[model samples]
Target: MSKFKKKAEVKQEIPTSSMPDVVFMLLFFFMVTTEMRKSSIEVKQQIPKAAQLRKLERKTLVANLYIGQPTEAKFGTEEKIQANDAFISTEDIIRWVNEEKSKLAEAEREQLTIAIKGDKDAKRGIIADVETELRKGNARKVLYTAADNSNARKN
Candidate 1:
């Protein structure tokens, strides 16, 4: 071949040896940053204020029960009990508690604490009904979640 003769050159391609590393890095980034919501709150609530406030020892062993006015007009303004994402009747609190407990390990079940988060404007009768249901469920521990007085209640 003459020194001046043109010749076909090999095509240069991007190296993919690092593609897996990049993909895995992205996967780990999302896994670490993404927060998966376990339940949605459909009620309007302002947790009551308390003189004393303490955090739970084991958050994993707690069942949350919410009592507040429905955010939707269709659900009416009456305070409705919410277990997980749906509105539940006071009579169903026992069942709801059992369902929540079932999600934990056997040892954690006994230590399960029923956390009642209620609206400050909610009626005491409804809360009393919830207490009755909790009694029916035989909940060993119950915690009434309230914000410290230092934290002003939202209007």
Candidate 2:
């Protein structure tokens, strides 16, 4: 009998046999769990054109207040304020702001930005009223949105 026995063979390769299955599972998880953040605009939004403008750095912190004429004939031709998807009065703004704040995380609540997007033809008086209500809500951080003068896409 030999003094030393033969050593058993050890495999040095990594197993990637389940890589495709794992990848597909992850892809499917994201596709099903993610919700799109687009808001349907029932009001016409022909945003004003500006000579100089800056873009919002963090869009996640913004709560938009859109001012435009209602598309539906029942709403009349007067400029209307749209928060989220509903038409609301100036008196409703404070409550709306609070609601928007509640939806944010604790750290993000203080950094909330109010974006007022009024159409070019929209009256200034209506916009001013919205601002007043926003102030009552203790929301001072504001942004007036406009489109680039030379942009091909108009919104």
Which candidate number would show the highest lDDT if scored against the true structure?
A: 2
Candidate 2: what lDDT?
A: 0.86
- Local lDDT at 54 for model 1: 79
Instruction: Please give the lDDT score at residue 110 for candidate 1.
Output: 82
Error of 2 at 129 (Å): 0.4
Give the alpha carbon lDDT tens digit for every residue of 1-155 in model 1: 65435443555689999999999999999999987978888887799888677789987888888888988899998899988888999888888888888999887788889888998888899988989878888885888898887546433
TM-scores of all predicted structures: 0.72, 0.70
Model 1 segments more than 4 A misplaced: 1-35, 150-155
As a whole number from 0 to 100, the lDDT of residue 128 in candidate 2 is 92
Clashing residue pairs in candidate 1 are: none
> Residue-wise lDDT of candidate 2 within 7-64, one digit each (tens)?
3345567789999999999999999998785778777888887756777889888999
Task: Report how far residue 30 has shifted in candidate 2, in Å.
Answer: 17
Off by over 4 Å in 2: 1-38, 150-155
- The residue-level lDDT of candidate 1 at 90 comes to 81
